[model samples]
Target: MEILAFIYFDPMYFVYVGPALLIAALAQWKVKSAYAHGNKYNASSGLTGAQTAQRILDAYGIGNVSIEAAKTFLGDHYDPKHKVLRLSPEVYQGRTLSSVGIAAHEVGHAIQDFKVYAPLAIRNGLVPMASIGTQFSFALIFAGIILSSWMDMPGARYIAVVGLGLFGATVVFQLINLPVEFNASSRAREILQQQGIVTAAEDKIVGKVLNAAAMTYVAATLTAILTMLYYASIVFGRRD
Candidate 1:
């Protein structure tokens, strides 16, 4: 039973990871609130997210990019691997601030792809490694602790260190991902105003939606960083 007690639930867990957890919680609320507000207001241009995306693509002279409808609400994304931009059903059809803001933001990623953005490339490369680490890093850390504590294993620290290194990949991925998301939002806001998709006053509402979404990413990155710090503190602090 003791061996199963993971470090995440331990007292040190709160000390290292609590604040970031609170930020994540707050960001989720902010996203919902902002999205709801933006959803209530229809765009003056009467263009749905799909149409807005097409206009942005055309303005940027980016052709050959496909825009498709995604099934879920707020599940929109740009798939660089497939050269596809997917907007949620609401965004694809609804003519509202929230819908167009999200659509424009995703198209920002497509724009990045056209330009061969460096961070996006780095982020894509890290996806496979991060996916693997997220699933097993904690288990490896726990096993390393149990082996050292209960079995008196000499190489337990090495195993734990390996887990820490694996965990670091997640942190690196999140850090690189931050700028990518922020830049997308920045581009979205600019083009929306330039094309008169939204008046200057209406653009503020779009900012609310985009900023709230950005905070979620910020919280995720902060959480990953704090988590890595906690793991390193425990694994290396007791070097004997």
Candidate 2:
């Protein structure tokens, strides 16, 4: 099966996904660079990332969500299911602009949850299907390809089509995720400034960090789109 992946290996796949891959790499580099640079300057508020999150939630009158230190580096995320905002060690403990920016971004999700953001609700609903698609879509695709191309099996193309459809869930998830992330960052910036967590000058630095982080999501969404198109061509363009 490992060899089977290579059997269908089309250079065109790379051609289709190459720009997105480059963008993804660049976005990651930008995130690391921006984070390192922003981490050097402390926010004027003198609040740790955890504190920043708490303050933002307090301002919004959202008391139910709890903030906690996360175990991994750069693993900050909001667990909507548990109403917990988990921050990485750096974000949770540091008082830098990077820390506050990231902390507030997670808090944005909590706010979204409080407001019942429609996109967020829809995205949560798609999570299970996207997970399943990410795990098994390629295997099914390869199996279908081998059956149709090598064994000339009947109805093999249908299997590939089904795999393609499943993989679409991931693309849909990525598309839906873009607005959620952008909205969170927008909310983060606005509330951060309005609450005096970041001075106007410092807000620019926070914007840099948050914008870099948002680019990563954009890259992922682009990658998912290109990957879907690449496989669609393969499955549907097979010689009859």
Candidate 3:
């Protein structure tokens, strides 16, 4: 028999999930819109994202990190494991504020790694568990629900509890990640100003782009939290 979670529920699941979904959609829209708006003009410094990131790293006395152009669109990221900063083509070579800001934000991660930022360290530490939890939590929950009432298997409750615990670790990971992202953006804005890479007006626009990017993280974390709560309510609501 296919498991329908909890057999039944009393808590209003949609009430929580609907808003989170809406926010996530809005965040995604903002990211695209903000990027498009910021991409229209070249920065006064005429430096591309890759160049700007290299300068910022040099400014911070971070000499070991390498920058590379990633062919993927909007695929910018900092790989701490390899000490490489990967910028999408648009960011790597584009002279627009959006490109610079986005690239700088990833470099901010590299900065955090160099400084041994506590929250980032914690977030990194949780990566393995969070990755496992994200991939397997739902499957385990469904399995547990399916076997809950099966007289032959008495371990259903334990399975469900383990699933919930794993998912809870994911939630913890998201919470820790928030500060890491915010701090990175803050550092990016400061560096842009201190280095005169962007004018005052341009810095404001950079903030807009970076803030929009941050909202996507917020939306994701919010959705994860609410979904976890909804599942938890159902899983624990029933007593065997």
Candidate 4:
């Protein structure tokens, strides 16, 4: 209780929290603005998201991947497990810049799969562990903290170390995610430009949309890294 109270009142806690919230808000604003601008400009190709995805796959000479419609908004994603690209209803049916850009981005992942992009491969391997780690990491950390305070035992310290290890996995996943996402967007922009799917004039808008979307991932990764660092500081600082 005393340790928890001390940590809670520590000015460093708020120091970290404040910046994280500010960054998160800015990221949200950027994402909303990007979506609005992208939606405002309809694609000249008149190609639905599914169509665009198929065209991209075909352009890359990828035959085995399937494109399908999903139920959620902004739900568009490529699933390597099923070899399917799923787009949200709006994206799947709409012929807007946002639709094509998003579809192409997902298809970009398919291209990565074909080429066996190393980062994507690493991310895929981390998914299961990261998922479990995310759910249990905090519980483990808190338990470790409480047990250490109560018993003053080394086992408690070990448990906390395990918690940190799990959380570290999540941090690594987020970091690797940045490169995979950026590479996918790069592929999307190049293919869109090369195929003349979007014109030179429209390229600016698409670029902004992709760039804005990439910022969200960057922000997420930054937030995760900061959070892990904050926890690590708390755990280690106390020991010294």
Which candidate number has the best TM-score? 2
**Clashing residue pairs in candidate 4 (N, C-alpha, C atoms within 3 angstroms):** none
User: What lDDT score goes with residue 10 in model 2?
Assistant: 53
Residues 114-217, candidate 3, lDDT per residue (tens digit)? 99999999999999999999999988876776676554475786787788889998999999999999999999998888899999999989999999999999
Off by over 4 Å in 2: 1-9
**Which tens-of-lDDT digit does each residue in 102-205 have in candidate 1?**
99999999998899899999999999999998988988887887788679895897788888889998999999999999999999999999998988988999
Of the two candidates 2 and 3, the one with more favorable TM-score, higher being better, is: 2
Best by lDDT: 2
| Ranking of predictions according to TM-score | 2, 1, 4, 3
| Candidate 4 per-residue lDDT over residues 142-239, each given as its tens digit | 78877776677757866777888999899899999999999999999888888878887777788888888898888888788887877777666663
Residue-by-residue lDDT tens digits, candidate 2, 1-240: 433564657577789999999999999999999999999999999999999999999999998998889999999999999999999999999999999999999999999999999999999999999999999898888788778777878579778788888999999999999999999999999999999889999999999999999999999999999998988887877433
Cα-based TM-score, every candidate? 0.95, 0.96, 0.93, 0.93
Stretches of candidate 3 exceeding 4 Å from the true structure? 1-12, 150-155
User: After best superposition, candidate 4 residue 76: deviation in angstroms?
Assistant: 1.3
Sorting all predicted structures by lDDT, with the top scorer first, yields 2, 1, 3, 4
RMSD of each: 1.9, 2.0, 2.5, 1.9
| Alpha carbon deviation, residue 18, candidate 3 (Å) | 1.4
Worst 10 residues of 3 by lDDT: 1-10
What lDDT does model 2 reach?
0.92
